[model samples]
Target: MESYKKTNKPRILNIVPISIGSGEVSLGPLYISSALKKAGFDSVVFFPDLSLIMHFPIKYDFIQHQLDYIMKQIRPEVVTFSVLSTNYNLSKSWAEYIKTNFNTTHIIFGGIHSMIEGENIIKLDYVDAVCLGEGEFSLPQYLELILNNKLTQENSLNITYKLKGKIINSKKEQVFLSLDEYPFPDREPLKYYYREGVLDSANFITGRGCPYNCFYCNAAMLNQNKGYLRFRSPGNVIDEIIEVKAKFELKKVIFSDETFTMNKNNLFKLLELYKSKVNLPFECQTRVEAINDDIAKELTNSGCESITLGIESGNEYIREKYLNRKMKNDQIIKAFHILKKYNIRTNSFNMIGLPGDTEKTIWEGIDLNIKAKVDSAACTIFMPFKKTPIFEWYQDKKLIIAEPNTNYYENIVIKHPNLSKLSLFFYSLNFNTLIKLESNKFKRMFKVFLWVKLFFLLFKGFLLKLIKNPLKLIAMNTFMKNYYGRLSVKGIIE
Candidate 1:
């Protein structure tokens, strides 16, 4: 491959790898693309149409055909991938395919997977560079150097690039002290795929980084030595919301922060400003320990339709001892009650397949949700992602049954002494059934019929997998959308 002289404006394409049923939009590529556009570059975001290939095996030329189409249409000189661990292999394969076929395009990988696995990622022949940590500043600077023909060195801040078969790690980039300095995310590229009636909600992040270090989380690993928490100004957040409201005609907004209510002073100030300026119904995820009467009242007063709490496990011992979530069951119940008192809906997130979990413990989780009377609940099998403390524990204990796959809802990746994979599957359905039974207001006879109907639906779902029917894919997608919508507190504000 030969280097081409810098053009007046470089064409860049950002790719986001999403699975078939993933209906939500991603912000990483949008942010990076926004920064690129702000720097006066031609940038477009591309989400590969994975609907056809998701359930089937990819032929050798399948990716080639897709890449050829995109290359001809966009003629991008720089290609960047925002990938998660689940889609890392897919992104790598695409990058390798591009390197083999294209002559002038440069490949860059970023996101959680690349940030944690940069050393191994840069070793790949297809990966030209990896952006570490946040790319809001690092990516723009890298592109500026390329546009000016000044990126001749092997290393620079917040970037790891390959040169002469040698990998070089750049100096770490300074974290942005405040998030308000950046422009709003470039959602224009997403407008290409935005369906009219499906997913009318817009998502924005008011803050970055997490204050708590749960064993299953990657926040601590990603923000080591860097500041643990950084927030945008209230005025800036409200300004973005106002812009999105006018542009997208958004029905609702979702604050996709790890813990939206982490800082009480900031939270109160933002809520006050939001009530006066935007006043749109919004939802947020927060810690169980962070909620109180005052906070819940303020959230409702500020137009918060719903709140999501991470009651990861029901057993206090398991939650605190194993998962490092220090919230007690009483606190979880109290939080739900407080939200209920304020007429705010509540959603609880639970996890079942953990190292020390048994059938009893899993049932206890369901019991906790039922007792809390949450509007909806979601339970997922535990996945030990690479670089997380839980993954380290699984590796040391030799309990890992398989590599972490892209599917977290339907797959079990660890071997428990007492829990079989089949048992886990059945237990997940049981949890769903319990949540429905607890949430709905139906007669006793209808409830029994509903239970039977749900059981058959689960059984049919299993059979669909065996036959590899396309209807199974549709059913799974529908099931996921409904499940997430229910857990999102859909009707609370409406």
Candidate 2:
């Protein structure tokens, strides 16, 4: 094994602990890894086994073997796990294993889960520290302390540490970096997906954070309402896209911002620059409230092949009161109509099985997608994340069915008095089909194929588990690549 010791810098390994379905690279770890590399530290990002859903019972020995193999090669001094509430348990298990085998190695946790539960997570015996808020600047600073052998709880910003039998969170004020201060995320870790033809498009974020305080969304809770939305200059963004275009064979560009049309003037400038320079068909996500006729026209002119709008629930009461998205159904329908008018594709993101969800409400959601004539629809059961207002409300009502450490991708989290978990799962699985049926989008031949697809999905878990471990691993790899690779291009009809 090649020793990183020759570099005279501590080696850091970052693990992104999430199930991959869309073949998209995680930008969080890439940003921090790039910052560490720029600061002359040895850092690398690793993605463990990807699955369609988190609840699939892949073998522990296989998972451990993959990690052990990587550790033997890199032998990092510090191991960091980029965590989400859905994958916290998986990360905890890995962190504990690393601490047990490599007793001298330090383990750190970061990302949304850490921001919400840093103090509690740091209390774990294996976790040396939890990084709070943004880590691009703070993480490099933390590593400098480790290098100088001056590491202590008091010295780092945005870090919570355990020392001397006490948990200590840094008193230093957190520093927020401007978007341009960030170097382009290191795409080296994502090369495996590209080489294997799993990823066809590059995922980039022009900004960080969101302005809206949706109850179910963790953005507000993650930043603690510090007003963290910030975007890079249009020129800065174009430079990165130009660099990425040169580096890879990308078919499309995905701007994975929470709200791409947040600022009209800035967005227009970006569109103009993109149309003239990049000219590649790109897709982005935005709120229905952010859409207008002019915005829709600009998007299409700039080669926006698709735009995803969050229509979390169809029942107006459920949408406004429960999810805190105040837009009316008329506005959502209008947004989709305008995008479709301009020949740009539209996709709606819906959440079934939310609090106060009933069969009637679930159907209303499907009906709304049909009414809006959405080109594609995606649905997920709502997961109440820790420390969010919705989670607290669910707790107050005693409606949560899952355990405290439930997987984020669990089929159902809250138990409604009138709705069963099975019903909700059924609704989510058939959501798109129901919409297509109502909209008359499916032909007889297509309907037959859809039924077969639904059957495979309904019994997918059991079928995958029936396979032996070795075969299961191979089956899963091939399934994820083909399934998610198609999804990555679902919006592009041509």
Candidate 3:
């Protein structure tokens, strides 16, 4: 690796605030960096090596060393982090460390957490400013202002900062850029995506914003803007794919839209253009309600390899009352059947331990997934993230036991009136097994086996605690947290 010598060329570094092993080509930082580049400023994206931070015994010193190395190499004049609630504390700590050590460098926080917690975040002494709305729109303006020494609290739009011991919340409305006005997101930061001078797979968003108001998500909050649900024209999308294909061997594309099929006409036109011009196998995510026979047919004909549907919960009451998802179970089953009819692989995204979730309700969810006959399913515990409607609802009901931890898989933070954290943990361990075991004949035996396995795990945990082996115990818990869908019960029948 070559080092970029320190220069006075207004170098900017955008951080994803996660481990390098993830290999995620984050669109947020890429888009921001590209926007800055278009504005005539030098920018680079940095993904720190934090593999050691994944385990229970976090190697803080090693991570700090890696960060220091990158910071010294690039020597960015300004560092910006795209923060998420899951890594808010870690990002904060990193910011504090950078500000303390690299005192001259300016620090800016942006992303979902900052959009919701801007004023509070800017109150931190180390934070220079907090960016709200799309960075592609505000970041370039903010940087230009800083360069010209014209940046002031009154003039800042979509930015919150502290001035003269008082926090100034910008009153100006954010300028939203049309999708076509922006350049293609820079892909240089994602080294892993490029193999042998070809891109193995890439994630691109055709549009922004979702129509549904899922309480647990920030989409509803983001949709308040009049121009939130903007999309690039079908021609613009085709041009990007063709350009990328010309430059590299593109094996696949993943549309990371909130709802890829929300606009039926636009999606159909895009699919038609894509099929005729660039028929690369791709995947996308959409709501169950958005899928229909025509949509399925279009997707299949356009070389869609897979589709992920958000079937958050099985219980209708919980889906409607708690999550604001009003689709019926019949709709979900029908959608899956339609996709299957088109020979498209289906993956269902499910969540357990929601605010109103019970053992019976969780079982209902598993049963629904089985009925849907999904090829694959993923289940995650419900983490009450700050600023989400569910978190505020929980706060109103005094259900919050403690502030949410970084790991959503650790346990449920909310104090359910009926279900305990241990109970929810056990349910999460067995959730996938129940869905994959579709045979009623073997289900009874499987249920018994699951309980026995749970008891064995509990006993092992107790012994580890008794022996004062906290590190091993933490490792065991982490392993089990992600072990939901990996187990196979075919051996039992054999």
Candidate of highest lDDT: 2
Q: Please report the candidate that would top TM-score against the real structure.
A: 2
Q: lDDT tens digits, residues 1-494, model 3?
A: 23455556689988776532123356888889888988887888875432342333555677677788888888788899998776777888999989998998889999878887887899888898899888897888887887677777677678876556677787467657789998888766654435443347777889877777788886578778777778989889888888777766678888888599989989999999999998899999898888999999999999999999989899999999888999999999999999999999999888887877777788788889888988887776777777778889888989888655455654467787767666566556546555654434455457677646654745553564436656545544654543333334333333
Candidate 2 at residue 459, lDDT? 52
C-alpha lDDT score of every prediction, in listed order: 0.76, 0.78, 0.77
RMSD to truth, every model: 7.0, 7.2, 5.3
Residue lDDT tens for model 1, 1-494: 01223356888978876542233567888888888889888887775543223424534365456556777677788899997877776788788877888857889999988888888898988888898867878888887776576775654668888666777788564556568888899988545334444347888888888877888886667567466378888889989989887877677888988689888998999999989988789899899888999999899999999888988888889888778988788888988988999999898888878868997788678878978888877777787878888888888989898866556676778887677776665566457665665456456457457657765756664664636756554554555455445434644211
For model 3, the local distance difference test gives 0.77
**lDDT tens digits, residue span 268-337, model 2:** 9999999999999999999998989899889999999988998889999988888889999998899899
> Order the candidates by lDDT, highest first — what do you get?
2, 3, 1
Worst lDDT window (10 residues) for model 1? 49-58
lDDT of 3 at 8: 62
Error of 3 at 221 (Å): 0.5
Q: Give per-residue lDDT, candidate 2, residue 485.
A: 48
Candidates in order, TM-scores: namely 0.85, 0.86, 0.85
